[model samples]
Target: MAGPTLRTYKAGSIIYFIEDKGSDVFVLQKGRIILISNSLDSASEIKEDVQKGEFFGVKSALGAYPREETAQVLADSVVLVFTPVMFEAFCTKNPRLVLQMLKVFSGQLRKVHRKVREVLGETGQQENSVELLRTAESFYKMNLKDHANYAFKTFLKNYSTSNFATRGQSMLDMISRGQPYPVEMDSLETIIEKIRLGEMDVSQNAESTNFGDMQMNDVGSMEPPPLDDFSQPEDMHIPDMDDTGLSNDDGSGMMDIPDMDLPDMDIPDMDLPDYTPSMKKPPQMNVPQPSASKPALEGITQFYYDGVNEFSKQNWDVAIKRFEAALSINKFENDAEASFLEKSLFELGRTYMRKGDLTNGIGKLSDFVKKYPRNPNLKKAMAYIAEGYEKKGDKQRAMALYNKVVSMPPRDKESNYAKTQLDRLMK
Candidate 1:
């Protein structure tokens, strides 16, 4: 190949090997490639078969680290390549794409952290008490009560003489009591802290750097694994419909996400008294409920009211549907945004974020920012984007947005949070 241009390859051709200097990322125009992991002990094992429309060689291309896996053509293939400079420009325009990459990095970090903790737990009995304690605590916080209880008990049995033994016993008692604990949202603050302290494999701007030193899985990462699977940033295509073939345009498709039911906070090992049935019967009272026929799920006023109600109750899916319905009305006949559109839009975006669809959520919130620049929640939206970028490891972008909010007038909650982030990042 002469440049960042189309390169054709025959079947069974080696694209590049692990540790090879790979400055360009390839997009498969046609045909297939197999990413093989040729470890010293094993024969070249097929790691993944990449197909069209997928992105590959990304880690090495942006990482500036040597290639971590080998890409071998499985068929006669035509590829389009982009150099590092081109890729960086693409990432800047579509930050969401960069966010997706960061998610994969975070997932890898989580896996590595777990593996380290496991290794520590296995190496020594007393030396790894802190690891054991953390293991128990993590399980408890994650709602894995059985695992927590078992780990705590095991820690207590083995490290009875250790300082943490008392705390382990206390945790066991708390587990036995089965009280509801405050459910904390998943966060990368720990990872952020490690990065800040120079203990993590991250750069000042993870979106642009910091993949070389880290151990990232070729096949198990969050993004698609093929060189052909990635479309251009300009395309910015959404994935196909869910299993039900339902489109995501209307919020009804949110049925894809299951209800977020908190696990019952009851002791699993409880053994109690048996009750004898009493002869006396208790009085029953009749309760009234709405009629079977309800409001036709249409119109701005109806849907808007319903949306607000659902949003307040934290029924994100329902709220999304109502808000979408309200906004979907024709603009000329009824001012599409007259009544509750602004608030509905904000909540719709928030709902998406709550359900862990950051790409869509950020997109929607960004739209709100553009359309309603003077809305009271403008700073709040900025705050969300800042936190979103922070969570996705785009610290530089996050810092810029947080700084923007801090400079604005009024010491509101969102501004205060932004100030806090600014302080933390500067330190």
Candidate 2:
């Protein structure tokens, strides 16, 4: 139940990405912000300018769903950030704000309905249910358990009496029990063979498969049902406001607005949830054993070198794919392979940063630091982590890390770099 906090973002900074967990709402107070999304047809980008004094992230945050668009700072801006509870309280005190938000929500819903109709083209409810169920199955096959869970829940919510509902509920139950969806042994063997022959790219498969895009496509295939069908039973109920109008509880006509250019204020730190993949072993699968001609360690080496080559060429996405493939091979291998694994992880983290995915970058780098505390690249990795924090608007934590680097021994290039950044931040 913490209150709203004011935060600032610089131009060229991303506030959040599509499919990020939506935990807080934002109201633009000054400067410019833009919400970026893909068109329903997936043929173009859609950019919506956020007007001053308007809310941008309300729907997803309130519904406890993933963000549907990316919010980017178009100019240096000040924004008031609110948790869902705080937003509800604010709406209760200013019923007019709720009315305004309703107008925006209605427009968005209408657009979504129209788009769904265009895409589905008179599809029956049964077909819609089947499509949604298939989407959930796709996620399950891809080993994206969380996404599969969400899609299954969405399917059950919309089509609980459909023939597929029982299957969807079964999948949900398995996910809750931490069980992986079953894959055919022959398909698993084929994948392994393709991987060994360099005929398939696991990195490409992992990186290119976007859960949000798949979910959206499934949504487009479904007939738009009544709003009540999607509504949660535990939704918050808003009370009717009396005729006294915008008056405060103490009779003040309206709450005062603060200056847009107010000085930097210290807001409590809000750490984002860690998104590191778990190290659990997958369900056992029987497959043909590998030939002695091509050892498993060789595959790891090839993935690592391929990643390095891609990184050298400035192909961030490809490099990330390769490094992730290498890391996925074996984390508990011998010392030589372990070294390659460590380097692959480090490069993967940096590649993510280059691709503007700071969350995963920081997570991977942090994991590297913890697993290999005495690594030769420890100082460099720490400096990169600090830079990621700085870009993410956590200047205080960034400065603290920079200070640590400056105080470390050897006076290396990384320490020098950290010192330079520290001085710039101090200004």
Candidate that would win on TM-score = 2
Please give the CA lDDT of all the candidate structures: 0.54, 0.60
Clashing pairs in 2: none
For residues 47-138, write the lDDT of model 2, one tens digit per residue. 99999988888888888899989999999999999988898899999998899878878998877786686678733233666678767877
What are the models' TM-scores? Answer: 0.31, 0.32
Clashing pairs in 1: 52-228, 53-228, 53-229, 53-230, 54-228, 54-229, 54-230, 55-230
lDDT of 2: 0.60
Query: How displaced is residue 78 in candidate 1, in Å?
Result: 99
Q: Cα RMSD to native, each candidate?
A: 27.3, 26.6
What TM-score would candidate 1 get against the native? 0.31
lDDT, candidate 1, equals 0.54
